[model samples]
Target chain A: MRNIWTICRKELGGYFVSPIAYLLLTMFALIFGFFFWNILGYFVNEGMEMIMRGETVPMNLNEQIIRPLLSNVSVIGLFFIPMITMRLFAEEKRSGTIELLATSPIRDIEIILGKWLSAVILYSCLLLLTALNFGFLFLYGKPDWKPLLVGYLGLLLQGGLLLAVGTFISTLTKNQIIAGAATFGICLLLWVIEWVTGYESATWATVLAYFSVITHFDSFARGVIDSKDLVFYLTGIFLGLFATARSMESLRWRS
Target chain B: MRVLTCFLPPSAGTATVAGFDVLEQPREVKRRIGYLPETPPLYPEMATSEYLRFVGKLKGLSGGELEKRVDYVCERCFIADVKQKLLGKLSKGYRQRVGLAQAIIHNPEVLILDEPTAGLDPKQINETRDLIKSLAGDHTIVLSTHILPEVEQICEQVIIINKGKLVATDSVRNLQARTRGVESLQVEVAGRDGSLSYELVQRRLEQVPGVAHVLCRDPHEHRLIFEVQSQKGQLTRGDLARAVVESGWDLNELRAASMSLEEIFLELTGSDAPKETAELTKEMQA
Candidate 1:
């Protein structure tokens, strides 16, 4: 456990010092902020129009505002998570540092979990930076904290899922390009599969959508933290991380 | 970690390091056996001291223990000068020192350093060799290097492995003693019958007691060539010389053939003479 924390500290410290982390953070802020502004603007305009007709707004302002912002944050995470994760194992192997790491007493599971946790924390921090969006919504209207907390929970869940997938992808190759591309490809597939299955009426499609990380994220974005949705995201997180640990273990003996 | 006596199999029979079974207890075995591969894997972004501290921590050293070990290894490997420098900026020599320091960080019972002096200049190589020698009393170091002098100067026991097989394992003096007879012994004889004389010499030499077998020599018009191997504890050079004198042959050339570690290494590793062998011989004499 100490070994895991040591690895985590160094890996997280590395992200802090390197330009890659800052670059990804900037990209995450810009893309997420842009999507949040556009989505909130459209939703607010529609809500104001509805109010002008003398009918209660369809959704409360908090739901109208924070939901779109946090949901879009999850979407933006699909891109930035891989940027930080692609270097975890891939760059270590490429630069010959993997040998040093593998020969140490640290377990494979610890190493994978350490790097995964670092990515998750960095991704969460990026998400936290956009918290001012919720503060803005709270200032002008009555805001319910439940959905806001649910929305943040959903964002963390989605980030965890993406982090696991990205870490597993990073283990597949020493080339960062391949790691990045493979991570993006897997997350993009999960995203598209959820949308496609939603269109079809197949009962299995609903099950697939239920399992889709993006779909499970919707429950959280809507401000309701369902146990089943939480379970689905947790399953994704565990499966991805488990596979990464296995990959590292196999590699240690293979060569 | 205590090292038990064992052998590295397939290469030979059984092997153990610090009482741990390399095959059965690889983890425990690894704890005692500090291995530095041909290329030491280093995180270039890390400072030498930071990397060593991390390795020490992973090896389960306490904070204070880690600091002491790190400093000891650094000073022993002569890497203290660049402990604060990032690994990326270190020279090939310093990098090798860093490799050695990391390998010895835990003060393992045995050290296995493969080609430890590979890329270092003469000064660095001497410093490394001196360090390895200094550590001999307390640490059992298995230094694998193509440099024969490294073995001669540092290793008390030399195990020569060729083609994944143990060709010889003995003290340096004993191996040199065993191979020295065959390697030396200049036969001085003038022959007129040419091929017939060579065969006669071979047959006659084999007939001598304490003489193993005589290797046929290259055809020199006036001189016949043959290599003589003696039985254990018996040298027949005197008898052979007397035979040549009695046979009425003019003894033209006779010299004892002594081989250096470099020559022995090349011969054992299945390679011809290294280009630098000549310079090494000159250096050894100087």
Candidate 2:
């Protein structure tokens, strides 16, 4: 565990010192801000129309604004998660520091976990940026915080799942751009897997839909914490990290 | 080297480092060994001290012990002056020093350095070699390089590998002695006549006892250089000198020629015939 934390701290320190951290933070916040403004604008316009008709329409801020915003955050994460995870191993390999990590007295699993945890932490910080906008919503509107918390949890799980995959892809190449592109390609495939459900309702389609990240995230976005969804994300994280450890093992042998 | 360091497993053979089987007790082997690959593994963005501290932690050092070890290595490698500078900003020599510092940060019992002096100025190369020599007894260093002078200057035992095969493993002096069987003699003779013919000198030297072969290397009018090869284990320098003088030639110089490490390396690894001969000789001696 100490070894893992040491690696994690080094990785986190690496991200903070590089310009990628600042760039990702700024890009995420700006995109989330746009989503917040558009969502809130639609909600306000609907509320005003209801008031002009003198009808008392229930405006649940959590359902109307928070859920959609959190869902949008998950989509935005598809782009930024790749950026954060691309350098985990690829940059190390490119700079020849992978030799140091490989020959170190730490287990392969620890290195993978350390790098994955750093990416998760960075993604969490990006999610935290949107909380400033949420804080504004809470100040003026009567929004239930529990559902918002669940929504944020969903975003984290979703982002972590992609980050884990990205971490695996990073180990495949020394080129960061290639790693990032491969990660985005895999994430896009996972995202669009649910489209098979739209075309058919067969067993194959149902399985494909179940495999889609968006399917598991739907319950969390709607504030329903299903055990199955948690299991899915956990399984994906475990499988991704397991594959990464395997790749790292092969790399050790080849080196 | 990677297998000995437990970074890579051997395909067919076993390796042990610091009394730990690399295949079975990799963690123990890793704990006892520090490896520096051909290129230094470094994070350019990190300061010299910070990178060393990070590597120290990876090698399982922490707290005051880590600090003390880091300080010791920083001073040992003479990089304390630039410890605060980012590694990328540092000069190549300093970067190599930092690489060396990380390898010894844990004070591992074995140091496997691949080409430690490669790609350095003459002064830095000498300094690095001196630093390596200074750490000789405390650490069992496995220094790998194609530089023969480095082996002569630093290594006590040499292992020559070619085409991924171990060609020979022995002390440097032992290898040099093994290749010294075909003794050579450098004879510079001044003839009575201004001109010296190669045919006359070659025929005369070949008739000398213990002389196996003779070649007129340089045939000048007043001076001639003859390279005389003696039969295995034969002392021919004295016999050749006497033969030249008896032949009415002024013997200016006659000395036993020695083979250098480079020549021995070429003899062992340069061709298939000599390699087979060396292996046959090894078997015969065994």
Candidate 3:
């Protein structure tokens, strides 16, 4: 546990010291804010028209506006997680530092957990930037903060799962380009797997769709917090991290 | 799990270090062994001090212990001068030294260095050699290099592995002695008759007990060569010269052969088959 934390601290330091982390955060805010602004604008216009028509608006303001805003943020997250994770092991292998770490007193599992935790921390910081949207929503109207918090929770979970997958893919090759591309490919494929496969395969697709990261956003988009959705996200994160540990261990001894 | 077998397959054999089974106790093994690959592995953006502290922490050293070990390793490896420098900005020699420093940070019982002197200049090489020698009493170092003289300079017990198999493991002096007396004696005979001089000298030298083979010829003026072989702890060079004179052949010159480390290395690594004649011809020219 101590070794893992030490690795995490050093790895987190690497992210902040380099330009990559800052650039990723900037991109995260710009894209997520844009998505939030556009969605909020459309919903406000719809709500006003419903009021003018003398009709009760059916959708909850948080459900219609903030949830959709952060869900789109989760989609943007899929692209960025790989960017952050592509360097974890791929760069180490290319620079020949994998030998140093592998031969160290730390276990393979410790190294994987350390790097994964660093990405998690970076993603959390990036997610914090989207809090501006939630703050604005609170200022503009009498809106409940419950759904917004849950939506952010789902988004955080999704980011964790995606980062783990990205870090795992990074261990597949020494080339960063390949690591990045492979990570993006896996995330993109899993992201849209349900849409491409059609309804005939909806059972496995629905199960995979539940695991798609997009599906878990549903519970958070509303004011609901389901333990099943939480379990799904946790499982995804665990499997991805487990696979990463195995990948590193196998590569070291395969020589 | 502190030790694990590497390089060779686990099924073939196993080695334990500090009560760690190399296969099962790999973590414990890693904790007790400091390994430096051919290339130094380090984060470029990190300062030398920071990186060592990080590694020390990962090795489970406490705060005070980490700082102490980091400084100790840095000072021992002579890298304290560049402790504040980023690894990327440091020169190759400094980087290599930093790599060594990290390996020894945890003060493992055994240190494995693969080609530690590579890419170092003569001065740096000598400094590293001296450092490794100084570490002999405190640490068990297993360093691998193609440089034969280095083994003679530092190692008390040397093991040579070729193509993934252990070829020879013995003391430096013993290895030298095993090839001793197989060395030829070079004789430059001067002012002697050309005809009987060649034939008579060969016959007289062959009669000596330790003389396995002799080749006497007029290279410039006249030279006689003897490839001598004797049972260990047997005979002297004076006996051979006396025999030549007793045979009514003039003896003008006689000297025992000398072989450098390079020659011995080639002899040891070369084929064990009947290539002694070809190697002999090459050695004579050398």
Candidate 4:
């Protein structure tokens, strides 16, 4: 556990010491702020239209605005998670420091957890940035905080699953660009797997749709926390990290 | 070295470090050994002190113990001056010392350094060699380098591997003594009034007891150089010097040519193989 924290601290330090972390934070906040403004604007305009029409349907702020915003945040994460995870092992391999980690007394599982946790933490920080915009909704409107918390939890699980896959891809190559591209490709594939279910109803298409991360996150976006969705995210994370550990073992042999 | 350090498992055999089987007790083996690869495994963005602390903690050091070890290694490796500097901005020599510092920070029982002094300036090389020599008593160091002189200067026991086979493993002096029978004497003589020819000098040297062959090389107007080979299992330096003096030739210099590690390395590795060993030796020298 101590070894994992030590590795985690160093990995986090690696992200912050370079301009990459700051650049990522700024870009993510800007994009999320835009999404927040657009969503809130659409929600207010719809409310005014309903009032002018004398409709008695009450609009729930959580569902009308926050849910769509949370969904958009997940979409934005598809672009940023790759950047967060691209350097986890790829930079170490390129700089030859992977040898130090490999030859150390630390276990392979510890190293993977350390690196993956760091990425998850950075992704959490990016989510926290979106919270500043959410703060406005809480001040003037009676937005329930519990569902917002649930949405954030959902974002974390989905981001963590993708980060694990990125971490695995990072171990496969020393080139960060290649790692980033491959991670993006894999994440995009996971995101779009649900598309297959629309065109066909075969068992394979159903399986692919089940595997899609968006399918699992849909319940959380609607303020629903099902145990099955939790299991899916945890299983994906476990498989990704397990594959990374196996790759690390092979790397030990090859080196 | 990789197997012994537990970085790679052996394919066919078992290995141990500090009494821990590398394959069976890898954690114990890792706990006991410090490894520095051919290139220093460093994160350039990290401050030197921070990096050392990270490595120390990874090796299970923490709090005051980790701080103390980090400071001790920094002072030992002469990297205290660059403790706060970013590793990427430091010079190569400093970076190498930082690499050494990190390896020893945990105070492991064994240190495995691969080509530690390669590509360093002469001064840095000497300092690193001296540092390694200073570290010998407390720590068991396994240094792998292509530089022959480095082994002769630093290592007490030498292991020479050729084409992935162990060619020789013994003390440096013992290896040199084993090759002593092939020793020759190089003699530079000023002839009487420049009257001697190459054949005359060669014939006189060959006449000496235990002298098997003599070859006159680089004939000059006033001096003659002859390389004299001793008979197998015989010492010929004293006899050849006396023989040259008695023959009325002015012996300016006569010394037994000791076999260098390079020559021995070639002799052992060259005979069994073809041109690859020669190329490898040349590469090592470069």
Query: Interface RMSD values for the candidates, listed in order?
Result: 5.2, 1.2, 2.6, 1.0
* Chain B structural similarity (TM-score) per candidate: 0.64, 0.80, 0.71, 0.87
Arranged by lDDT with the best first, the candidates are: 4, 2, 3, 1
Query: How much native contact recovery, as a fraction, does model 3 achieve?
Result: 0.66
Residues B1-286, model 3: lDDT tens digits:
1123232236456788767777776777878877778788889999999999987876678878888898898889899899999899998888888988888888878787877888899988898888877776777777777676676677677665545455566667776776775656766543245555455556666778766667654444535544455444454778877787776666777776556555665676665533222211000000
lDDT per residue (tens digit) for residues B1-286 in model 2? 7778777788887788878899999989899888888789988788888999999999999999999999999899899999899998988888888899999999989888878888999999999988888877678888777677778777778877776678898888898888887778788877787566778878998898778888787564556778888767675466777888998988888876678777888887875544322321111010
| Regions of model 3 farther than 4 Å from truth | A40-61, A196-208, B1-11, B183-258, B272-286
Q: After superposing candidate 4 on the true structure, give the runs of residues whose Cα lies further than 4 Å from its correct spot.
A: A50-57, B192-196, B219-223, B231-250, B271-286
lDDT of each: 0.74, 0.85, 0.76, 0.86
Query: Model 1 chain B: which ten-residue window has the lowest total lDDT?
Result: B277-286
Q: Which stretches of model 2 miss by more than 4 angstroms?
A: B185-214, B218-256, B270-286
Highest TM-score scorer: 4
- Residues B152-250, candidate 1, lDDT per residue (tens digit)? 776777777664456677777776776665544556567544434777667776776677667766755546766666655566567777777666665
Q: Rank the candidates by DockQ, best first.
A: 4, 2, 3, 1
For candidate 1, the per-residue lDDT at A251 reads: 68
**1 or 2: which has the higher TM-score?**
2
Docking class of 4: high
- What's the residue-level lDDT of A86 in candidate 3? 93
How close is chain A of candidate 4 to the true chain A, as a TM-score? 0.97
Native interface contact recovery, model 1: 0.30
Pairs in steric clash, model 4: none
